[model samples]
Every structure is written in structure tokens, then in C-alpha cells.
Target chain A: MAEKVIAGRTIQVNDEGYMTNPSEWTREIAAEMAKEEGITLTDKHYAVLEYIREKALAGETLTIRKIGSSGIVDLKEFYQLFPGGPLKLASKLAGIPKPTSCV
Target chain B: MATKEEYPLKKVLIICAKGNLEDVYAALVMANGAVMEGIETKLFFTFFGLDAITKKRMNCLHTATVGNPALRMPGGLPFPTLLGILPGVEAGVSAMMRKEMDKLDIPPVKEFLEMITAGGGEIYACKLAADMFKLKKEDFTEEVLDIITVGQFYEMAGGIGTQIIFV
Candidate 1:
């Protein structure tokens, strides 16, 4: 048994830590997830989220540590902005054809 | 079994020092390759490289002449330096290069920068070069993220897997 819902979606996390349906994920999905997590999704949040997703889709596989090193924004602020946090947000929004472990 | 690391060259920093045809072409090739490989690419233009981004000089970049072996004339004819001085020679070469790039689906320098930035890559202008060249912020393409020092560029390039390349 694995966690089905992190923020809002009924996502299935495998034992290997991959999202079952990563292709269906999008920035809007992440935004909605953030909302369900009790966080407001602002344009700036979307910008950062989208940027991260683009990089991930490009196959960057950004970790929280790597995200922190980017210097695009503060890590603490990033945490507060995204509901599922960097790793989840990056995985959900990365636009990868399939979901793999982002942890 | 060992799993190979995927998405090599995740972070690329392209230092553009010349805006001529070969230089700009080199930068574009590298940047495009990085983008295709899903890497985060950044292009920092300095000195002559700034010309590639400037509105006035971008379309007017010249071809390199000195020390280029392919520039020799045929039939044992000595290549005339005056031909380079002729009007539209540089423009013609630039046009041809642009056509070839377009055929290859490589975006223009400005649009390429936009695509890179839009795709999660950062673009920066060299502050020292900008100041030395007396270039205002408005003089550069709007895709420029900021005017940063070389140290700042290093800071961006500093990471476990980041790569810094000069093209």
C-alpha cells in the first residue's frame, strides 16, 4: 500500500517511488495540488513551478538540493509556495512522459 | 546491474566571446544541443559576443577572414581582400547562414535565447563588458535575465554536475 493523495490527486506511488501517471500531470495539476495543500498558487509560484517542470521534462531530474543551488529563489520561500514541496512539485510538473522517483 | 545516470550535462553555461558567423553559429549549435538533451542552458555574452544580441549588430555580423583555410579562391587565384570590403558580402553570408539555420530549425539568436529562457535556462549579460562597451540595458535583447559579473556567472555554474563551456 502506498500514499494515493499527497495534495489532491489520487496519485499512486510505487515501491520504487515512481508516480504511476506522470504524463497526466501538469502545472495546473500542481497548482490545484498546492491549493488542496492549503497554499495559494500565485503567478510567481506558477512561474517557478513551470520553470522547474520544463527543466525536468528536459531530463534535468532536479533535486531539492539542486533546486536550492539554482539561486532562482530562496528555498524556504519555495517550500512555503508549493504545496507538495519541491520534489513533488517537480515530479508532478516535470512533463516527463512517465513518472520516476524524484526523491 | 548498475544503472547509468541519465540526462548528462544538465546545466550548461555558454560563454560567447565573438558575434561573427562562426562564433554565433557555434554558440547556437551548443545551446541547441543542450536544449535537445534536456539540459538547462545559459548563454552569457561578453565583449564582441554582445554584438549577437544587439539589435544593430546582430544582423550585420561579419565573417572571419584571417587564418581561415576554407576562404581560399579557386583556380589558383589569389583571394582578393577587397571582396570582403564590398558591400553586402557580410550581409549575404549572414543571410545564407540564417537560411541554413532556419532549414535546420535552429531559431534566431534572439528567439533561441527566448526558447532557452522559456525552457528553464537563464540568460545573462556581462556587466563589465556592457559597461566597457557603453551598452544600456535597452540595447540588449529583452530576453536578457540580468547583467551579472563573471563571479556571478561562476556562482551560477558552481554545482556538482554543472558544465561551463565557452563557444
Candidate 2:
């Protein structure tokens, strides 16, 4: 584990940079991480991120299929929202643990 | 101390030569998973594996109840090969398998292919197998980009950090 200072607040993160405590996340922190991933978080991106964080916190297994049916963005749009490894990147940007799903 | 270097796979060429439900799903899941990971993936179906892309048979794939020793009853009992010979047993087992996979949010063959293509993964069918089975281009689902020979497939498979998998 590592302590990362993001958006001027220190947060606990795992080795791969996923926040250990998602409750520490903020829009500013997400914006900083999104910039690291070369993404510009729009309202559309935030909608999907928020939806995913909610499902992930409730212990729902996150998959591309589940995200496609999320009604906010379809699978293709989700991929475009966070290009490479969408679910993984989204989880990290959403301040959740790295996703372990393979689907 | 010497440290191991990492060379992640950049491309995957997956070949599915069997038509069984498990075989086709395995290929699809791998291809989909790879594409989702930002790896370039090409799926090639050959021999009976064409059933996975064939429009009429794609969604109705059957598990080999008779020969799959790993098959089991719902309660984890060994599924007898003799019982597999009963009429409709294979269909029932295949349906059960689909249901279980659905519970895991796994999609049917059609949607799986769609998901792969939507993510820019290309799907192909073996030319020889298609010719032998009298399958035309139109016989396959639209997800199949083309019917190609092994030579063409290998040509595309050539690259650093590329691996070819046969299922």
C-alpha cells in the first residue's frame, strides 16, 4: 500500500494506484487521475464512473456487459470513455479497487 | 539480482476448431477478454467451430454430454455417459449450462460476438472448413468479417508479443 497525495489530500492506494478507500475520492482527485490516463472527464464520464462506484461498493461484480447495460453509456461508449482497459481504468479513476473481473 | 522483464501480449490470434458449447464459449470469452484489455484480437473458427458463427446454429450450441467426462449433475454427482445417450439430454445440459453462464452475466454467442466486434476485435471463419461444410459468407453472422485461409491468418498473426491459441 502507498499513500498518494491527490487533489491536495493524501489517500491510501494500492500498488497499482487504485485507491484503497474509495470514500476518499473527490471530483478533483478523479480529474487528476483522469488526466494521468489521458482522459478528460466530462459529465458523461462522471455518470458512468459514479454508477460503477455505486455498484462496486455494493459488491456487484463489474463487467463490460454490466456496464453496457448501465443505461448511461453502452459498451462501445464506455470503452471510448476510458479507452484502454475501460473497466480497470474506470475503477481506478472512480477511486475503487482494481477490478478482478475477466468478462 | 536479475529481474524478469515483462512483455505483455499485444495481439492474440485465437482458433476454435470444435463446436461444443464449452469450446466456443471459451474462445469467445478469451477474445472478448483480450479486446477489453486493449489487446488486438482475431478470432478464427474452423471445422465444427463454424457452428459458433453460423447464423442458424450459433445460439443453439450443444455441450457434449456423451463424451465430456467433466460433465456433472446439478448436485455435483458424476454425470453418467450412458445417461447422456438419452434423447434430449444434450440439449437439456446445454440449456442448463447457458443458464448458469447467464447468471454470471455471460452473454449468448451472438451478443458475445457483437461485444467483441464493438470493441474492434475481428472475427473470421476458416475458408477450407467453410467450403467443406458448404457454408457461404451469408451463412455466417455479420460479426464474421471474412472467411480466410490459414495462411492469411498466420500473416496477420505475425508480430512481436503475439501468441496464437487453439481451442
Candidate 3:
């Protein structure tokens, strides 16, 4: 485990840069991590992020196509927004662990 | 069984040997999960698995009702295997399953392939299976990178930390 300091708060992250503790997350930390991942947080990004965060907190697995059908963005926009691995990257940016299920 | 840390998998090779909707989706789901976890992933289609990558037949896959021990009714009732012999039963079951998955917003077979590739996953069809079916390269969707032999499949699975999963 590695520790990263975002917004002057130290938090543990896995080797893949996902937060180990969800309770330690803040919007500022998300912004910082998104920057590190070469993404700028937009309103659209926030929409997806918030949705994932909520679903994750409720103990639901999130998936790329599920998010695409969320009425927030389509699949093409999701791929465009998150690039390499949309659901994985988005969940990491949302300060959550990678979902174990498929989309 | 190997411990997780003992096999810090670098890649996952999923072998889709059955073309049944459930079987193909199982392979797809696992490969998609691997790519999401930052592991390199590839799907190999063989036997009936060709139905998943073939452009004409991919979307028309049916559920495997006969001999499916896991099949059950909605209320946890075990579905009798003998009933699977009914002509329309398999298709009906498949349609119901697809409807449930659609409600969860699961992508269809084609879009599922696209999503996996977009996440840096690769798709391959087995050479012998293709040749037996007389399938030209053009018969498959563009997402298929190549039709390869089982030896080549072994080679693809040869690297350290590579795991071959049969589904």
C-alpha cells in the first residue's frame, strides 16, 4: 500500500492508484486524482462519478454499459470521457475499488 | 489453488467453447473484468463459440437448456432438464434471460465486443473451427484480430503470469 497526500489529507492507495478507504475521500481528492490520471473534472464527469459513488456505497457493482444507460451519457461519450478503461478508471477516480462484475 | 499474489496475472486468455448465450456472455464478462483490472485480455472463440464472433449468427444465439444444471425457475425452483426438449423452450428461456439482462443495461454481443476492445482487449477465433465451418475472415466481425491454431493459442498463453480460462 502507498500513501498519497491530496488536499493535505493522507490516504492509502493500492498499487493501481485506487483508494483503499472510501471514507477518506473528498471531492478535492477526486479532483487531484483525476488530474493525475490526465482528466479534468467536468459537470458530466461529476454526474457519472456521483452516480457510481452512490451505487458503490449501496454495495452495487458498477459497469460501463450500465453507466451508459444511466441517461447521463451514451456509450461513445463514456469511452471518450474515460478513455482506456472507462468503468475501472471512473471507479478509481470516484475513490472506490474496482468493481468485480462485468458491465 | 494458487494464491492471488503468487499469480499477479499479467494477462487473461478466455476460451469461449460454447456458443450458447450464457456461455458466450460468461466469457465476455470475465474478459471485461480482467481488462478493467488493468490486465491484458484476449478472447478465443472455438466450436460453437464462433457464434459469438460470426457477424451473421452472433446475435441469434440461444440458451443452453438441456443438461444445464444451473437452470432454475424464477422462484428458485429447479427447472427440469427434460422440459428442455421442448422445441421453443430454449429460445423462450434465452429471450427471458436477455430481457432481464437488458433491464440491467447489459450491452448486446456486438457492443460488448466493442467495449472490451475499447478497453484494450483482443478477440481471436480458432483456426480449425473456422476452417471446418468454411468461414472466411470476412464472415467475422471486424473486431476479430485473427483466426489462430490451438498451438498459437498456447503460445499466446505462454508468457509469465498469463492465465488461460476456459468457459
TM-score of every candidate's chain A: 0.55, 0.97, 0.92
Cα-based TM-score, every candidate: 0.56, 0.97, 0.77
**Runs in model 1 with CA error above 4 Å?**
A1-103, B1-7, B65-67, B72-82
Each candidate structure's count of clashing pairs: 1, 0, 0
Q: Which has the better TM-score: candidate 1, or candidate 3?
A: 3
lDDT at residue B43 of model 3 (Cα atoms): 95
RMSD in Å for model 1: 10.4
Better of 2 and 3 by DockQ: 2
- Residue pairs in collision within model 3: none
Candidates 2 and 3: which is better by TM-score? 2
- The Cα local distance difference test for each model comes to 0.65, 0.93, 0.87
Candidate 2 lDDT by residue in tens digits, B1-167: 99999889999999999999999999999999999999999999999999999999999999998978899998999999999999999999999899999999999999999999988899999999999999999999999999999899989988789999999
Q: After superposition, how far is residue B57 of candidate 2 from its true place, in Å?
A: 0.2
Which candidate has the top score in lDDT? 2
Clashing pairs in 2: none
Cα lDDT tens digits, model 3, B1-167, are 97655768889999999989988999988987777667889999998899999999987789878988999988999999889889999999998998898887677899889878876789999999999989979999999999999998888887789988999
> Alpha-carbon error at B21 in model 1, in Å?
1.7
